[model samples]
Structure formats: C-alpha cells, structure tokens
Target: MNITKTDVLWNYAATFFKISSSVLLLPIILHKLPSEDVGIWSVFSSIAALVFLIDFGFNSSFSRNVTYVFSGVNSLLTNGHDTSAQSGGVNYSLLKGLLSSMRWFYSRVSLTLFLLLLTLGTFYISRLLNEYHGNKTNVYIAWGLFIAINTYNLYTLYYDALLEGKGLIRVSKQITILGHLAYLLVSTVAIYLGFGLIALVLAQLISIIIIRTISQRKFFNADIIYQLQNCEGDDKKDVLKAIYPNAVKYGITSLGGFMIQKSSIFIGSLYLSLSAIASFGITKQMMDITVSIANIAVATFLPQIANLRIGGNYDRIKAICIRGVVIANLIFITGAATIIFLGTPILHLIKSNTNLNQQVLLVVAFSSLIGLNSGISGAIISTKNHIPFVKPSILSGVATILLLIVFFKFTNLGLLGMAMAPGLIDLCYQGWKWPLVVIKELNIKFSDFKMVIMKTDKPA
Candidate 1:
C-alpha cells in the first residue's frame, strides 16, 4: 500500500489496540486493587500529565518546523510558509540543528522534571497516602520508579517529533502498539500476581523502553544518519531562537488545556473520598478513549493539512475540517452511548469494585462531545501554523480550574462536582468559542457547514 493509506490504517489500528488494552486492563486492576488504591493511581496518572505543561510545546513546534525543513525551506517562521516558497531537497543543516536543539532542550527539561517529581511530586503523593490502607513503602518505591521512567521518556521526545514530522505515522503507530502490547502483558501479569499499583508503573517503564528503542532505530535510519552526520549544523541556539516564540505559546496552550481537563482530578481528590476519585477517574478515562477515537481523522491528517495549508488550498482545508468534525462527533456519540448503557453492567460482570454513576457518565459524555469538537477546530487551526487561540484557550482552561476549585470549596457536591465543573465552564468559552473562531477564520458559513455534512469531499 501507499504511504497515506498505510498511515490511515495503522492509525485506526493503533487506536483499536489502545481501546482494547484500556478496556481489558480495567477489569484486572479494579478486581485486584482496592478502591482507595485505584483512586490514588488515577489521581497520580492525572497529575503526571502535568509534566507536559513543562514541555512548553517545544516538541510539536519543533516537529512542525522539521516538516518545513523537509519541505526544502531554509528558515523557520512563527506561522507556516507560503506555497510559493516550496522548493527542492531537504535542508540537512536545519534538520540537524533542530535535532540538536530538541535534544539539548529536552535534556535540561527532563532533569528538571525528575527533580520536581522526586521532590514536589513525592510530597503530593504523601498527602494522598495519609488515609490509605496499602503499604506506604511499596507506593513510594513505585513512585521512584515512575519518576525515573517518565524522566527518561521525556528526554526522548525528539524521537517522536521526528517520526511524526516526517509523516511516519504508520511506523510510529505500529511501534506504539508494540510497546502497549508489552504494557498489557506485563501489567496483566503483575496485577494477577498481586503487585498492586506497583505493577502499573513497572509496566509503563517497560513499555517506554521498548517504544523508545524501536522508535530511535526506525527514525534514525542509515540515510538520515548519514545526512545528519555529514551536515554541519547551525547553532542550536539559533534554531531555538527561531522556534521559541511559537513553542512558548504552545506550552501555555498545553498548560491551559491541562488546567481545564485534568485539574479537576487534582482538586477533587482533596474534597472527595479516594473511592470517589477512582470512580470519576474511570468514567473520565473511558470518555477520554472516545475523545481519542474522535480525534483520529484530524490527527492522522495533520501532516497533510500542513502541506495543504502551505500550498494555499483553503478549500481542501475546509473540506477536511468538516469531515473530521463529523467523524469526531459520531465517534463521541456512539462511544458515549455504549459507555453510558453498558458501562456499569460491564464493570459488574468483571466484578470490579468501582462503578460509574449514570449522571456522572452523562455529564462526562457531554463534556467529551464539546471537548472533541473543540479539539477538531484546534487541530485544523494549527495547520495554519499560527496559534491564534492561545490566550483564549488558556483563559478557558484557567476559568474551568478556578470554577472547579470554587465548586469543591463552597459546595458539598463531591464527585459530581468534579465531573460537572469543567463541562459547565468549557461550554461557556472553549467549547463553542474555538469552533466559532475556526468557522470565522475559514470563512465558513452556517449553511456551508450544513451543506458540507452531505458533501463527502475527501481532503485533497
């Protein structure tokens, strides 16, 4: 098969593997671990995502610029280049510089994250451990391992940036599936053997190692290696200087998004019981799978979108955007219904200690719909290479977190508060605001949106 078709199939296949693994693992963990421990694990997982906030969007910004270099561009810009600027062969010097810069930046950030995780992260976990029934020492040991694994994983962000930038989505996804397979096998065995929370972290560490080793071997092939080595790279500082402005904007956007989507778990843990946190976490996780599924089309087409935008084909961009939105909404609707209808029964069948309430599930479902729609808009907007919604996006997330904090503090709404706060806040700003902004930017009319629903024009 050709590259695009290969990537599309592997992308869907990767998502299928992920959804399967997530569904399969829940039963083992929920049955093996106590409710409180499950909650603690869920909270830790949420907070660990905070490490991305430290990334400052450097990886993505760097990768996008990598695509430019590969497209024969000599210099980088905050936004993408014009179609007329497209020229000949890859600029090895720029590619070399970007790789060096990515490594240097990630090296420093990885160490900083390790320190923070060892110190502040450990302290946060300690607080959660106060009323827990599990062995404290085991959790601490797992925490140490987790910090080390994540630190090393963060250091290898360049591997992923390069692979995805080169549009090696099929290989990249295949590598990811292999790693997740290892994760499933190890975690399943560990949980079955009664390793508790430690098993999950251990499995993750194993998965990362497998993924990075394979990804590095694949991305840095003989030809790429010769090219990079032969080229005299520009100074890393120069490359960073060219990319930092947009990268920082992306970082702020990342932070704001985390605040909106994940801060609820962090704040909610303080007010609700650990069991409640676990329930909310599971429900949210299931919906997150739906969100991931919904995003497949846009994510798969990102590199193509970049090329199309640079070629000044706004019509194709519009067509792709409409189709992606439709697919995303349909995925979210179908996945949400299944989770709402079969979720509890499935848990019961597996003898899981935890359950998702229908009300919380409904709220979570609605939020996923909006979040997925907004995400589609954001991904489309990103292809333009300008991050116009950075401020507004961050503001929406910050507002959501603040509202969640207030809800937790003043009211006794408990777990429901955690699920509902972001939904309410996001709908007011990011949920609708981003799509509106996207439509305006694309010059898409309401009637155009309606008409495109049936148009079935594949992105050129």
Candidate 2:
C-alpha cells in the first residue's frame, strides 16, 4: 500500500525508454533501410501491435487479481473483488491457482495467435510481398523472427501481471528500461552493420527474452517458489472462471479503445493523401506521448488503488485519485502547450517528410485531455472490479467511426475532420460522463475535492 515518488519516476523512465526507443530507431531505419523495406517493417510493427491485442484484457485482469491476492483477499470473484473475507495475509494457494490458470490461458492463447499468424498472417504478408521490391530473402527471415518474437512474448506475458500485481513497480520499470535499452543498442549497432530488417526483429526478440528472464527471476525468488511449491489442490479451473467475466469485458474494452484511437489512421488513408495522414499521425503520436506521461502517477499507483479499495479506505482512495487526476491534467496542459508551439518547428528543422498541424494538435489535445480525465475516473471506478464503462466506451468508439465516415464523405475537413471526430464524439459523452460518474459514486463534494487538491490530506 506504500507508493513512492521513486516508483512514479521509475514508471516515467520506463515509459520514456519504451517510447523513445522507437523514436530514436526511426531515423536509423529510414537512413539505412530502403523506403520499401521501411514500409514493410512498418507493416510488421502494425501486425505486432495487432497481435498483442490477442492478450485481450487478461493482463489487467490477472494483474488486478494478483494484487488482490497479495493484498490479503482469500477468494476471487467473477464480477467484483473479494474484500469481505479477508485473510490478512497473502494467499499462496490462491496465488498458485491463479498462476496456474494464467499459464494455462496464455499457453493456449499464444499458440492460437501463432497459428493465426502462420496462416492468415502469412497470407497477408504474401500479398505485401507481391508489391515489395526489396531483398525478399531478408524480409522473409525478418518475418519469421517477427512471428517468433511475438508468439514467445505473448506466451511469457504473465510475468508482467505478476510483477505489477505484486506492486513491484520499481523492479518492473527497471526491467523495462533494461529491455528497451537492449533493444535500442542491439538494433542500432546491427543496422549500422547492414543487418537490415532482421536486426530490428532480432533486437526485439533478444529484448523480450531479457525482459522475461529478469521478470521471472524477480517475481519468483526462493521464498515465492517455495511457497507455491508447498501449495496443493488449488482449483485452477475455478480460478479461470472467476477471472473470465471481467477479463472478457477488459478485452472488449481494449478492442473498442483500438477502434476509437486508431481508426482515424485507417479511415484517413482512404480520404486523405499520405502526407495528410502522416501529419495527422505525427500530431496524434505527440498527443499519445503526452497522454502516457500524464498517466504516469495514475498508472504507478494503480495496485495501491486496488489495495485501498479492498480495505474500504474511501477517503484515501479519493485523495489519491484526486491527486493523480490533478497531476495528469497539469502535465497534459504543459505538454500540449509545448507541442502546439514547438512541435512543427522541430519537425521542420529535422527536414522531416511531414509536419504536425497545430490546428489538429490543438483539437486532439483537448480531446486527449478529456479522454485522460475520463480514463482516470474510469480507473478509479474499476478498482471495485465492476466495468460499468465498457458499453459506453464501445458505443463511443462506434459513434466516432461512424462520424468519421460522415465527415470524410459529407465534408472537406480532411485531417482536421479526423481530429475532431473522436473529440466531438467523446465530448458528447465519455468526456463528461465518466467523471460525473466518479463524483456521484464516490459522493465527493466540491469542498472534499478542494481539500484533496490543496494537499490538506495525504493518501496512504
């Protein structure tokens, strides 16, 4: 239940490393690889991202449940957390069962994803190869490595759940920094040596192995191993059942999120030129960085939030949430202002292919700020283990997509249309509703919020 400034800083470092590795690699990639090869690699990156959604919502579900078990909850529930029957100590048997179920689930899911990649993914790659004018042999080798990395990464994904669930934020962030550092170093050197696309995928594969290995060692030290080994007759099937409901909700929510956040790029490609899409994409990417940095404190304190929820410490929860939201907004506002004023000039200085549109950036910034607020409010509500926002999220996503189509066909807004579509749709519902939901659910008055914002009370 003890979160620290150090924990938050580590999380920020991890996020920076993870995001910057790709940013730093981009210039190298464009410089060394052919444009065709770079395009193909971009496709591979997209596919890798899509493949990761195969994890659905299980990671968060598993992590939350792990936190619950670690927080002294004796049993798992299908829809809500088990706060009533407290064990007042970690439940090794429950942990063992949950771990068993996680392994059983991920093993099957990863295998299924691999099969899908081998078959359907290969078919799609073949179509791309028809148009590809690169070194075919190297591309094939890269594709093989890409599939292996993704499949193996998915298989070992439970390591993430275990680490974050145990509130090992510092160690988890350390592992992230190390893994991404390996990725950046290996890929940079190999590309400079003319390894081409293979270098990138190979770097990623090594990074994943390093991360999973360290995570395994960190989470399963001698004491934990001994405790799990001594546990017996745990019902993994029951554990899976208990996790299934919320996990599926989380997975669907993820899909909706992808649709809301990413559909613009796909839809924009149809109506706008590549240059326009690229500009919009750059602006969106900057906004994404803003969002990630803004969420650092909230993400770092999530396990503690869940722990507080289990203890029924509503006041402390309110204080923590209020602080998290306040910090998030302050960060976002600063980031957005900097991007608005400085983003395009920097892109111009780099002699980039495209520039960020300040108008688009400003609109997306507003939308993203709203999204961040709603997201934090939703996260607070989720600590009770009830996913009330799923339907609204999905509906908002659908509405955004539909509105984008209308904008593309019925108006000449182009990239501006793309930025405004999600923002306008969100502003109508999710932007305001979720925060209101949190206020009502937590029964927070203006005075209480003011007190928390003024730092009159500290969250445990």
Candidate 3:
C-alpha cells in the first residue's frame, strides 16, 4: 500500500489498540476501587485537563508552523531543488530558527502560567477534597500525579507536533501503543497490589515519559537539533511573533472546549450526588473512547489540510474536509448502533450494576450522535483557521452549562440530563453553524462538498 494509506491504517489501528486497552483495564479499576474513589479519580482527571489549558495554545500553534515548514521542504525537494546547497537549505534553517525562538518563549511563558494554574487548581481541589472526603493525603497524591501527567503531556504534544508535521503517523502510533501497554501493565500490577488511585496515576505518567523519551530519540535525532541550533536570531524572532496571535487564539478556544467537557462533572459534583458523578463519568469516558477513533482520522488530515492551505490548494482542502465528515459519520453510526445494542452488556462487563449500565448507555448514545456531527465541522473550522468560530464555540459551551443548570432545577433527569444537555446544544449549534461558516467563508459549493462525502476511498 502507498504511504498515505498505510499512515491512515496505522493511526486507526493504533487508536483502537490504545483505547481498547484502556477500556479493558478501566473495568478492573472500577471493580477494585470504591465507587466514591472512582468518582474522585474522575474529578482529578478533569482537573488535570484543566491544567493543560495553561498551555496557551502553544502546541496547536507550533504544529501548524511545523507542518508549514515540513511542507515547504517537501515542495522544494519534489521540485528537483538541490537541498544540500546553501540556499536550498534556507527554508529548513528558517523553520528551525522559528521553532527554537518559540520554544524559548513558550518555556518561559508557559512555565509561569502552568505553575500559577497548578497552584490554583491544587487549592481548589484541596477545598473540594476537604468538603467531600476529608482525605488530605489522596488529594496531595492526586496533585502530584496531576503535575507529572500534565508535564508529560506537554512533552508528548511537542513530539506529536513533530511527528504529524513530518507525516510520521506510523511512528507516532507505535509510540502511543507502547505507552498504553506500559500503562496497562502498571495499572494491572497496581490493582493486584491494592495500591489505589495513586498507582493508576503514576503508571500513566511513567508510561508517557518513557514513550516520549524513546520517540524523541528515535524520530527527532541530531539533525533536527542541529537545524534549530543554527537558526538566525532574526528569523527565529519573526516566526515567534507571527505565531503568537495564533497561539493565543487556540489557547482561548481550548479553554472553552475544556470547560464544556469537564464542567459537567464539576457542576454535577456541586449540584448532584457523587454517585451521579461516577455514573456520568463512566459514560463520558466510554464516549471519549469511541470518538478517539475519529480523532485519529482528523489528526492525520489536519496537517495535510494546513499544507494545502499554505500551498493555495483550496479545492483539495475542501474535498478532504468533506470526506473527513463522511468518514466520521459512518464511524459514529457504527459506534452508536453497537452501543445501543450492546452497551448494557459492555457496562455489565465493566460494572456489575444495572443502574450504571442504563445511565452509561443513555449518555453514550447521545454523545455518539453529537460527536459524529461535531467532528466534521470541527475539522473544517480548524483547517480553515477560522479562529473567530471560537466565539460561537464558547457560546455553545455556556449555553450547555446554563441548560444543564436549568434542567437540574426543573427536571429530575439527574445525571443523564447533565450529560445530554451539552450534547444537545452542540448538536444544534455547532453542527449547523460550522457547515454554514465553511460554505460562506471558504466559498466552497455545498454540492461539491457533498460529492466528496459520497465518494469513498479505501478504508483505513
């Protein structure tokens, strides 16, 4: 098979393997830990995600720059340029220059920002822990694990940016699979030894650190380092300045997304019972696993789309966007059907409780529908650099929160209501608005876009 097809297959296979491992292991964890502890773990996970918001869009901004640089280098080589010549190597030098400057800037700005947020999150979590369980040690351990996980995440994002920019999805997949395997082993051992939540968190962090170290050595060797080192100061500064706006924009957008996804749990904890939070958390985790399959496809296509834009290839960009939407839809339909049919059995295998099963299935079904629709439009928005869409995205998130509050006050739908509220809003707003934005801003014919969806490529 050709390289592109191989990469696509690798990504899908890798995502499935990693997510499957997590799913398999999670039930064992839920069984081992008390339900209350499981609920707390869920809260910690969400808080850790919030820690990443401190990233200030650095990763997204860097990925776009990296992709642009890689594409420029490829274009030069494809056009029969002698890359070894001084001027031929100019673009590489320029890219490295920019990367180095941005890395320095990010290291300084992000470190301070992350530390501040970590402090705030730690204090907030501490208060919640005191109010809920009065367990200080677990809270401290949770914070420790959260820090390790977030730090490792920052490193992994850098590696991922490089891998995706270079179109090395297969290598990326290998790294991910290895990381997940390590986590599975650690989680299993921890459970067997009765180590509780700390074990799980530590295992996850160690797995990421090891995988990132190995991948960095394997894929990003001395040549890339040398390129960065040789970059001129002026060129480096220029790139950093150019990407600053994009980085901030992405950072703001990401915060909105984080709030939408995690706020439900936080709000549920405040307004509903802990058991309700656990039930809802389980459903959300399952939906995340299902959507991750589509995410692999989106990640693979994003760099390509960015490159197409940089190269002024609008037709191919639109075609890829539409095709991506179709693929996402099919995957979602398959996932939703399976969940609707077998969700109870799956939940039984994970948790022996019928109530949990019913609640999880309900949330997963709604989430699947919303995820499928949003995935396509989200891809297009990201590729089109329509950062302004973030305003509406935030609005959708706010609306979700408001609706959840109202539903909780007026209705007895409980956790299911909380889970479905956001999905309902996103399905109505993002699903409709993004397509219209794509058509209006990008000036692509809706019919042609639809044609790309109807056409099929070989399955990944």
| Candidate that scores best on TM-score | 1
Q: lDDT of each prediction vs. the true structure?
A: 0.83, 0.83, 0.67
For each predicted model, how many residue pairs clash, with residues at least 3 apart or on different chains?
0, 0, 0
Off by over 4 Å in 3: 1-3, 73-90, 131-136, 231-236, 349-360, 439-460
List the lowest-lDDT window of 10 residues for candidate 1: 77-86
Per-residue C-alpha lDDT of model 3 across residues 64-156, encoded as one tens digit per residue: 666656655422211112223332233666566655765676566546645764787677666566556535686578667767677657645
What are the per-residue Cα lDDT tens digits for candidate 2 across 128-165? Answer: 67756768898888988998999999999999999999
Clashing pairs in 1: none
What value does the lDDT take at residue 190 in candidate 1? 89
Q: What is the C-alpha local distance difference test score of candidate 2?
A: 0.83
Against the hidden reference, what TM-scores do the models get? 0.96, 0.91, 0.86
Quote the lDDT for 336 in model 2: 89
TM-score sort, best first: 1, 2, 3
Cα distance off (Å), candidate 2, residue 369: 2.0
Model 1 misplacement above 4 A: 1-3, 82-85, 445-460
lDDT of 2 at 62: 94
Across 313-430, the per-residue lDDT of candidate 1 in tens digits comes to 7887787677677777888899899989999998999999988888889988887788788877876777667787789778888788788888788887777777887788778878
